[model samples]
Target: MNKDKVICPCRKLTKGDILKAVEQGASSYKEVKKATKAGSACGKCKKQIKKVTKKALKK
Candidate 1:
């Protein structure tokens, strides 16, 4: 897990954190943030969150 994948560029959440939350069943922007503090910052990671959520939902 790269601690530098930058899941949320705004909140500075790495991919590992986000993916971990996803694995735990976080299926939305709010869930991601709540689960891993990913978008609790400037909010620039909205796009990335949505994308990850979409992918996660597919699984």
Candidate 2:
């Protein structure tokens, strides 16, 4: 798995998808979900998404 690539794994969301969500103003985990529909299913991607979201916003 790519460290910087945020994959939902469950939903298979790509790093670009998460990055775009962050760029679109998804600062929080829940907000990211709304923006990308990533962690909405299964919830397995919650931790990964959260971590990447944090890093993406800082960038």
**Cα lDDT computed for each candidate against the true fold:** 0.75, 0.81
Candidate 2 lDDT over residue span 1-59, tens digit each: 35456488777788788888888888888898988789888888788788888988877
lDDT (Cα) of model 1: 0.75
lDDT of 1 by residue, 4-56 (tens): 68777766677767777888988787888888777767777778777877776
Worst 10 residues of 2 by lDDT: 1-10
Which residue pairs clash in candidate 1? none
Q: Flag clash pairs in model 2.
A: none
Off by over 4 Å in 2: 1-6
Number of clashing pairs, model 2? 0
The true-versus-predicted C-alpha distance at residue 33 of model 2, in Å, is 0.4
Reference-based TM-score of each model: 0.73, 0.80
